[model samples]
Target chain A: NAGVTQTPKFRILKIGQSMTLQCAQDMNHNYMYWYRQDPGMGLKLIYYSVGAGITDKGEVPNGYNVSRSTTEDFPLRLELAAPSQTSVYFCASSLLVLPDSTEQFFGPGTRLTVL
Target chain B: TQLLEQSPQFLSIQEGENLTVYCNSSSVFSSLQWYRQEPGEGPVLLVTVVTGGEVKKLKRLTFQFGDARKDSSLHITAAQPGDTGLYLCAGKDTNAGKSTFGDGTTLTVKP
Candidate 1:
């Protein structure tokens, strides 16, 4: 399986601009998540979906939106980008949340710079 | 909100030496995971400890979860240059369906 894959390895956006970060998983995972990693800040969850048509806000959901229309795809949208949004974004998926099956498969990550 | 704090935010050591890094939190978790990340890449899972006081070892690395389920530690024996990376610990909140990540410990092993 290709596991989880994210598009646009690198991107630069002007202030107030918008873009969609695409993610897909071939594992048919029911849980997909979007996280951003800032220098020395680790990974912060932006949004997540339990399944298609369902999404929830995470710790840092501001300026971001997500849609999980299929089991394989979970895309993150950044509207009116700001310099604060500059960070590396990662997409991950897991088959289940049980103790033994919660291992998350993560994508290579997309580096975003907002000016 | 549950927060995880990692110690020795940055460590530089010579190859063949041993080192340990810690991840502590005040809140309990259902399970905890360890991951290693290289520059420009996402983290890859190293191991997950569910039961408290559980110990799992991978090659030269050993991972242990605290008996109270509030902390964990990673110990590397005879570290190598390949072991240099960002080590992160994440506490899983199954009920919330999310894992809280630690700031991560950056390790640099010199040959």
Candidate 2:
């Protein structure tokens, strides 16, 4: 299983520009999440999906959107990008929620730079 | 909001030395996890502790969850250059239905 994979390993966007970070997992996980990591900062969740057609806002969801149309794909959209959005983005998937299972498989991550 | 704080934000030590990194929070969690990340890469899960006072070991590394379920510790014995990376702790709050992450501890092992 390719586990989780993210597209555009690196990207640079101008202010006000928009882009989509694509993520896919072959593990058939029901839970997928998008997180951004800043230097010295662990990670801040942007959005997550319990399943296809169901999404929720996480800790830091501003300037970002997500869609989980299939169990395999969960994409993050950044609209009107700002310099504050510059960070490394990661995609992760887990079979179940906490108290039962907390093991999350993560993607390599996409490095984004907004100027 | 639940928050996790990691101590010794950065650590540089010689090979063969031992070290411990801590993650503390006032909020209790249903489960806690530890992950290690390398430059330009995403974090990889090291272990998860679900019970209070739980202890898990992975090779030269040991993970312990606080008896109150509010803190954790990661101890590495005889560290090697391969162990150099960023260590992160995440707590899962069942009530909040979300995970809180600590700032992370950066460790460098010199040979």
Candidate 3:
């Protein structure tokens, strides 16, 4: 099913440059998320969507934005990229949280290096 | 926000040895999931425990959920080099699609 797929597996951005990280899932999951992982740190949530028209902020949502135009896609937008934003980003999809889904399917991850 | 903490942040073991990784938290949960990730790749689900005090076995690996659903453990009966990877535990939170993930345990198995 190709599960979840992310675009631009790697990217290098300059100070103040902006870009969008693309994430899509073919499993028709109702929940999708964006997370970032720094060296020696656990993955922190940046943004998430419950459906095509509903979205919410997560633990670390600063310097980033997200849009859920369709149930199959959730893209993260980085505005005025900073060195602090340089980290490995992952996209994940799950059926639903709470009483339904406990397992999450993750994407290949996008490695970003701000120079 | 709820938080999950993992112990033995790093472990190095020889082949055929036994090893255990722990995930703990103070907040009660309905379910817990374990995932393993290799370098340059995303995490893959290993197992999920829903009912409290539930125990599940997969090949040489065993997973247990705490009776209170506040903790979980993964035990490897016979470690192999293929088991070398980062292990993470996550719990479903009340915040809809959000979840709390523990700091992963990185294991290195020497064969």
User: Candidate 3's residue-wise lDDT over A1-115, tens digit each?
Assistant: 9999998999999999999999999999998999999876678999988899888999999999999989999999999999999999999998874574657899999999998
Residue-level error in angstroms, candidate 3, position B85? 0.2
Q: Could you give candidate 2's per-residue lDDT for residues A3-114 as a string of tens digits? A: 9999999999999999999999999899899999998789999898888999999999999999988999999999899999999999999888447486888999999999
Q: Give per-residue CA lDDT, model 3, range B1-111, as digits (tens).
A: 889999889999999999999999999877888989999999899998889999999999999999999999999988999999999998877445577899899999999
Which is the winner by lDDT between candidate 2 and candidate 3? 2
Worst 10 residues of 3 chain B by lDDT: B91-100
> Which 10 consecutive residues of model 3 chain A have the lowest summed lDDT?
A95-104
Error of 3 at B54 (Å): 0.9
**Model 2 compared with the native: what TM-score?**
0.97
Q: What is the lDDT of residue B98 in candidate 1?
A: 81
RMSD (Cα, Å) for all candidates, in order, is 0.9, 1.2, 1.3
C-alpha TM-score for every candidate:
0.98, 0.97, 0.96
Which candidate number maximizes DockQ? 1
